[model samples]
Target: MTSSLQRAAFAGTYDDESLCGSGLMVVRAEAEAVAALAGRIDAYFAAACKLILACNGRVVVTGMGKSGHIGGKIAATLASTGTPAFFVHPGEASHGDFGMITAQDVVLALSNSGETPEILAILHLIKRLDVPLISMTGNPKSTLARQSQVHIDTSVREEACPLGLAPTSSTTATLAMGDALSVALLEARGFTREDFAFAHPGGSLGRRLLTRIQDIMHTGPEIPSVPETALVRDAVLEMTAKKLGMTAVVDGRYRVLGIFTDGDLRRLFEKAGDIHTTPINEVMTRFCTRVSPELLAAESVRIMEEKRISALLVVDDDNRLIGALNMHDLLRAGVV
Candidate 1:
């Protein structure tokens, strides 16, 4: 049977006030459930984490129905952080997938009522393997909670569901507890940003931490360059040809002397100098900033922002120009 709120929604009798009131009720209920979890993070929670940390193999999380979905996300968060973990459906675990859990692994079982049939079905197998069992349940006195080596209390005062049949608040509490476990384990292991990058190599944070200037900088023939003796016109021609908005001024030995850019061209224009006659080195900015190929693209971003510059030149040990890059390059590489 639906609640009055549900009936009103179905009958199109709900106004904005009623709709918002019902939505707020759900939000408040879920919020209270999650808030209660803070106090529940007691000794039992620590014990669960200890079991996971001491495990030699992996964390095998299993649950039935809605709990299974939360288990999958929890497992993912655990695996991505520091602890290796994966989700297994309780129904599937009884069907030979139980072989996946060895004595070296720890099993984390989820069941709000603490008496899910599928979860209980795997208890004998889990016991046979002598694996550590950690359970999260709303009932501390329930069978699953009693059988587990460690039991975390995820009980909610009320479900957000109007009829109290849906998983609403229970699932949120379980997911929050899962996050707490994952992050606690992560901190205990002293997981670093570099370690996280290895797990998420394709993510923006990974790209920022792992990408070197050489990986995104214009290299070889793509580098815009001109000899110091080259006229302003020649430098402008090279810049336009390379489309980098600037050209490196180098000596005959290819060692960088300075840089000529669009800004310098504008200054030259104000002074009424003949672009074809004036040498680039005479009008270029001397002692221009340079970066090494091994520098991180993220570091280059800091340098650019601090110096209020839009472009940078990449140089080798001998100060020879090897590459060039602008802010646009960093943006394209997602370093920005």
Candidate 2:
């Protein structure tokens, strides 16, 4: 009963079950290839890391075709993770980009087939310059692997492509190997979070690590504060004026004695108390959360979250009020 148009529409269309099975097969094959690499991490890997660490200059990465695309990403990862590296196109190397590579540099080359002509063309130049060469390939006996000081086998049992021609599993294995190398070198170099923050100063992680409490706090007259002797109504006025949801109660020396918030006001209202005539000290919270100016804003966020508070008072070693801040400050500064 199906028309010709309906038959044509279903001819090449895959059922959901077939599509899901095909996708899972590709993922499993690639995962197995990456897992196999764990056993291949030996002394050669250590030597490669040592060579890169000892290099006086950069790590030069080179490859051809699809390998070249993966090489660029690997180079970027290495550079961002404490290793200085860059990608050089094998085709461009013969056209003068080779000058970017120096004897002080270590070359990391990629080629699925060990006989890539563009890469092999530069092997002689690399040797003449006395630069150490590291190769990643599927074929161990290929010319590229034989000429290198270290050979990382990125071989997959079979291509994930149904035709066994397009690169799928092989590229995944190579990229995972690159990540392993970058992370190993990152740890070996003792790279710290601060170093990472410096590299990514504009990112959210950088903001969290580098921003200090003093950098985003409200100081001077912007801080809502009142003398301990002030009335509860006066404290409320200050809080409303500053719109900070709370006010600090301080002694004659400007040392913080307690804090009063809108929540306390609501509790006082339930008791039908004369808040306008009541001393602020009587209703204020005596034990308050305070932080030093040098504390990281990110850590302050954790304190606020743990205590379920929205505002914090910044104080000095002697407990004298220096500044004030609330959740909004952290949010505006992108520290949250």
Models, CA RMSD each:
2.6, 3.5
Candidate closest to the true structure, highest TM-score: 1
TM-score of each: 0.94, 0.89
* Model 1: lDDT of residue 300: 99
Count residue pairs with overlapping backbones in model 1.
0
The TM-score, computed over Cα atoms with residue i paired to residue i, of candidate 1 is 0.94
Residue 22 C-alpha lDDT in model 1: 90
- Scored by Cα lDDT, where does model 2 land? 0.94
**Clash-forming residue pairs, model 1:** none
Which 10 consecutive positions of candidate 1 have the poorest summed lDDT?
5-14
lDDT of 2 at 259: 95
In Å, residue 43's CA in model 2 sits off its true spot by: 2.3
lDDT of each: 0.94, 0.94
